[model samples]
Target: MSFLNYLRVWLACARYSTVRTMMFRFDFIMWSLVELFWMTVNILLVSVIYRHTREIAGWTQYQMLLLVGTSMIMQRLMMGLFWSNLFELGRNIRTGQFDFFLAQPGNPLFMVSTRKLDLDGLLNVLVAVSVVAYSAHQLGLHPGFGDIVTYILLILCGLIIEYGTLLLIVSLTFWIVGSQGIEGSYFTLFEFSRLPKEAFRGASNVIFVWLLPVVLVSNVPSKSIMHGVDARYVLWLLGVTLLWLLIGTTVFRRGLRRYASASS
Candidate 1:
């Protein structure tokens, strides 16, 4: 399908989600508050930690707040846009509901991932951005237009990495009986993204920083805002984003080929 056509389909799905959310106003409000509480706890933890120490892996409190906020933005965007659909993907595959996407006119991955929008997640993105802005103000950092653009671009790269990682994990459902445990592990692994990159040492550095894109996703973008954009960091993040995207799509397609529809 044309790009415009795919966009139209997504808009329709988003509209349905919005109407559905309106019908459960209390549920929506409660979830939004829950997420806000979680975000507040993260900020408070940073504040409390800095009370005892001056810096963590060279990151001051506000600097660390920026990192946490950056991670939140990418995650919130992912949750809002693709998490619900992806979370249900494994169940759908197991129940042979994967056939629904196969019958759709659009690309299956796109159709599946874009079928729902979590407005609460999207709403929390504003809160995350506010945290970042407040941190910037506290740090007395005035980023230029180019720097702001670079920061936004890097955030987008982080979002793609987040999506690719989750998609890659969920795609394993084709071979495994269920991906429930693995899906939960996704959060466990990405939880490291909020930490300062310099906090990792030895094997932890090798695993989370070099091997996985978890640290790169949030740290690189936050660092760009703090210390100005560096070509090396930008290039490394872009390279990893592209690699993950390639891996995610390849695995999903391979899994789809093995999928057995309800009919067959």
Candidate 2:
């Protein structure tokens, strides 16, 4: 198919899926309420911690809220767009269903990554945005036009970092098929993002900032908003994102050749 035809098909698929999701009104409402409850619990947890100490890991109460908000946004984005289909990649590879994707006209990776969407995850995103907005208001930190632009860019970078990391993890399924432990490891990674990066000290902090790169996903953005933008941090974030993307694509392609059809 032509490029325009492919684009049209992709758009139509996304639109149809979005409309299909809207049909589940009750599900949407209940999901939103559940997300709101979790957001409340997060706030209460932070409040309780703050009561015992003036600041946690050099971050004030509002700053920590922003970090939590950023983490929540990352989690929502992953769950909504990526997580839902990630596990299926392993199954598809094991059963040779990926051959169907390979036969598709468009990019196979794009088709695989966007095959499904979890609309309920949008509730978490909305709640997280609300928390960030409320925290900004309480801090009396009105983002200027430039700040808004930078924040958007930084958040986009953060999302890329997150998605790349998750893709890397999912790609491991190519080698470790039927490993139920993979999901648990992914969840553990998610749990790590809940606390501020500063909570880690010494070697552990170095590992998170450099090895895992989770700190850049949330902590850096929170710091940018609470403190000021750091050029070095931004550069490092972009570098890490590119590195992960390259590494993930390489690993996935290597595994692709090993995928044998189920019938075989």
Top-lDDT candidate index:
1
lDDT string for model 2 (185-240, tens) is 66677666778876888997888767987777787777787778888887888888
lDDT of 2 at 36: 68
Top candidate on TM-score is 1
Q: Report RMSD for candidate 2.
A: 2.2
lDDT of 1 by residue, 93-201 (tens): 8788888789988799998999999999999999999999999999999999999999999999999998999999999998895556678767888899999999999
User: Could you tell me which 10 consecutive residues in candidate 1 have the lowest summed lDDT?
Assistant: 177-186
The lDDT, on a scale of 0 to 1, for candidate 2 is 0.77
TM-score of 2: 0.90
